[model samples]
Target: MDIIVTIFSTIIDQLQKPTLAFLIGGMLLASLGSKLEVPEPVYKFIVMLLLLKVGLGAGISVRDANLTELLVPAAGAAIVGVLIVLLGSRTLARWKGVSKIDGLATAGLFGAVSASTLAAGMAVLDDENIAYEGFIGALYPFMDIAALVTAIVMAKVSVARRASNAEIAADGTMAMNAAPKTEPAQIEGLEKGLVKTILVDTFRSPAISALLIGLAIGIFAAPDSVYDSFYEPLFRGLLSILMLIMGMEAWARLSELRKVAHAYILYGIAAPLVHGMLGFGVGLIAHHLTGFSAGGVVLLSIMAASSSDISGPPTMRGALPEANPSAYVGTSTGLGTPVAILSIPLFMALAAAFIG
Candidate 1:
């Protein structure tokens, strides 16, 4: 019993640490709409720095990590990404009764991994002195792309299916709400082009580009003085500043969140836990099967818990413009990421309990 208390206490103590406190403080101030602001360019720079640090850290550690051993977790990350979209979208549309487009959009937002959330998870791992394989950071792109592609494709399919079922009117024309009648060739060409464009854009995204570059550097390059100066000396300080900025951005949507339906709001809070537990469960299984460490399992769980606030909304907007941005953005940024941040320690605790 004492040991259990000690474990939770340690987790709580970590959450309350001063660095995370800036996140809390930023939220408080931003929710009030205070004048304090992180300039747009400065925020971008900070984000870039954090992402590079993560990549570099992964790079350094990855040399010692057996690339072949990462296959299970990497595959698991992709599977979990798809699951989050499928399950999350269905639950929203069927259970909460949101419109199909809105439900699918929300699913995409949650289904995708949040880069900021990943950054926070890394910070937590650093704070706890937990050691995980550097290649784990490489898993970010797999989850990110999977979630975005799943959401976009599923949303398109749902719209098409609904259109196909529409009854023909007495005048021998399609129903107004049905997809506009078009030649099969035109439709096929349009769909093909759109899908190609989305695929291209998703891959070309800046975050994905940065992550890939970092992975290449980490994997191919030998250790150098630059690694120590860039990643070790400066990572956390920049990350703290980044968290403060994210806190502001998140709370900026406070009003939008207040307007969400109670059912949707509950989904926002609960979905992360469900996804997080699922992620952690997979990580645990992989650990046993593949000999992955506890810290790696915990890190995977954290990745699963996050939503794709950065890349998700824009992609959903382009693909499903009819979907409500308020629901997806408010739910992802306002409720989901914050919850993921808070839940990461609990996940770490779970990993420790199971793997220790």
Candidate 2:
């Protein structure tokens, strides 16, 4: 259809060139071991801008976020994403016979949702005049909940497996504080190494902080412009830091990805495609039931694959070095990363034109 082609063209314009540039730039920087780093505050600043943008965009669309009507499709997408993360990650981990830690890591990693990527999607959708609601921002928080839950579940599974195998010996028992060891079933209650790190990072990261802040602002203020004067410099700085950091992060990953190129290709590409299709279907059905737009549907699907590029897999790797972390992490990112960029523009155009 003409609409599809046009949407593809727009996505191509945004993605094809940008992704290539990202790869090339990442390669050069990574190869050179370029010290080009995003300062801590700068990273925070960028997140603030993105969060503000997401909040403003989402806030303006609140009128469209009717629970009585819109909940069906939104819930559908969530269900699909949950199934995909739960079943998909478990399937891959089991078939691969990856280490228990690796399996759990993959589950937690895959379950998480990425707000930045979704923000990019929102940007693309806006250009296309799509009619998606701002509550879309909630996807990030929702995914975090999933990631948190999955993390606990996976950790418990790993603990159980290790216990059965007698891997968590006397020495290991001492290392984990001996308290939770008396009963490994307390995964949900006691914090472990990986989950602890994730929780710390989740709160410590300014980006997450800013998103929560933005949500609060949106809730309190009518037109977001009312508080615009406060975070002026922070917002302006966010865009540049985000762009440059994106390149830097891509480069960093590309360096490590060389070893497991094949796996990355499969996981990254496959994960998003599966999620995207689910999202599209959810959007379509939502529309049929409550007249949600096609654009909204597409955006929902694209968002399913969102998660931290550096955090999830690295957390897995650090937590369980024995699982050949590269296979799961590299493959997931390699395929997901580039496609993620394109998904933003493509889904935005789809959701905006039809749903907006």
Candidate 3:
């Protein structure tokens, strides 16, 4: 009974907060046709600051963390990433009759992590005074890369199989311009090169780089250094403003999302919930294994619920050129994010009750 009351109280508290009020205000304004938007450069700067702040905060706490405790959860994150792609892709392909490439690409987009959403989750944790380990940021890139690579590989393999079957039907004569055949040795070399390129690109992502740099500084820099001065004052304010921008961006995309098929809408809404629940399960396991508090469970579940707006789409475009960009982008940014924002807290509450 107290759990129910607590959850309800949390919801009410979230609704009444100034930060969420700003986010809601931005959405209402955009929906009412106000042309308000944060300038692109300003938005970019805010994002950089938020990422750096998160990284620094994580680094500061990481000194006392058991690094070994992260190994299982990290591995679990990869497994869950692959599972999300498979589950989401199959549902889209089978139920919605979406093309294999498009379905798989959409899955990848939703399967990958979102740094911004993670930031929001962190804000919630802070407001509630929830305790969580800081090193979870280190697990982000791994999960992000895993989901993307799985989706790409699935799409490629599906294409190759179809091409091979068609060729076999045509008496072993490959059609012109129908996926060029390469020698086995060339294929092996290309595979190695692709892996290297992906690693380079993944680590080079702004969010991941910031996290890594922060981790380094946190591990090596002395406590109470000047680094403490910058992040402490501005973190919450920047995040609030960023959420307002996010609300505007989400509203702006609503028209585009409406143009998509109803089936796509259903898929978009359903996919993230599925991922969130599964993520909640994974968070529970991690909590038990690592002694994560209720807050950490929620944050972990939030990480699982997030779909990539930054890294997933570009990787999908490069790997699955024939994929429908509209579907992928709409689902990830327009649908998945909103669902995640609303539902992640509920998942957290659930985690709190169970763990308590």
Candidate 4:
């Protein structure tokens, strides 16, 4: 018991960032190409923890939520994030000359929420006795469901397109043995890699499994066994692994930097601006609708600020290995967080002073 508490404390401490310093350290490590190898089980554990944390936190968040008043904004932000995935995928599909599936998979990643950022918000708010992170967590499942559906639909469409298109040319791949080698070896390679990397990994994620379990428990009214002691140890261990995977993934991002083009710029600059504005809007609306103080109002930004898009490059590197997502995640985490840290207090103060 003492060990569990001690370990939990250490994990949270290790995961947090004081400022740009964590990013700088990450960048420096990237530049050095230091082989910081995390164990395979550790990676899986991280995914479990990451998803579990996301699920558990989200579960706890919406437990007593006032669905009537809060559901709208929660649904709105979640929906908007999905819409952005569709729009962003369109842009990428057009530019990258990839299948709709590929575009969807890529865009879906960006559309997904970054729990690390939200975790940071939770940390900040908890420190101050504020109550807004819960609202953001409550909205997260919508983001996951949207991403899953987008990926599934796009994957099916993309696969069908591959089967139908003459250009697909999967000559040697599961051919009818007389299709005259329709797809060349190279094209087959691309096709095989893409299918395995995007569709399979997305579908087979353990985090998703755990989340569904939590959702079932949420809806079905589980006994204390399912909620309390049942997954407690798993949850804490998962939390540590999640942060560690984040760190490991961060290392991969630094390794592959050159391939990323202007996307890095969008993540660092455009993302934060969009996040702050939307978060502030959400906060303001939340305030008007409910009587939450300014501090509570702007807590939305903390969740909005740190993005999975910032982590997009790093994330891609893990699966694709063809793209270095670090520049996006590292640079944006560096830029977005500090600004958010500074902006949050100000917004909360102003909201409280003027609005209250």
TM-scores for all candidates: the values are 0.89, 0.72, 0.88, 0.58
Global fold similarity of model 4 (TM-score): 0.58
- Summarize candidate 1's per-residue lDDT along 1-356 as a digit string, tens digits: 75577568766887686556767778988877789877888877776766776776677677787766778888889898889888977688666547777777888778788877888777788777898777788888777778778887777776665555543343355556344553333446547766677777776666666666777787788645776867667777887787787688778765686666666788888999999998998898889888888888888888888888666777777778888888889888888888888887788777777787
Q: Stretches of candidate 4 above 4 Å error?
A: 1-27, 30-35, 50-54, 90-104, 133-135, 151-204, 215-248, 263-269, 290-356
lDDT of 4 by residue, 94-155 (tens): 44434354445455554555555454455445555655534455565455445445544454
Count of clashing pairs, candidate 3: 0
- List the global CA lDDT of all models: 0.77, 0.58, 0.74, 0.50
The better candidate by lDDT, 1 or 3, is 1
Q: Rank the candidates by lDDT, best first.
A: 1, 3, 2, 4
Model 3 lDDT tens row, 14-105: 76665566667778888888977688899878877777767666667777778767776778778878899899766886664577787888
Indicate which candidate wins on TM-score.
Answer: 1
* Worst 10 contiguous positions by lDDT, candidate 4: 320-329
* TM-score winner between candidates 1 and 2: 1
Q: How accurate is candidate 1 locally (lDDT)?
A: 0.77
- lDDT of model number 4: 0.50
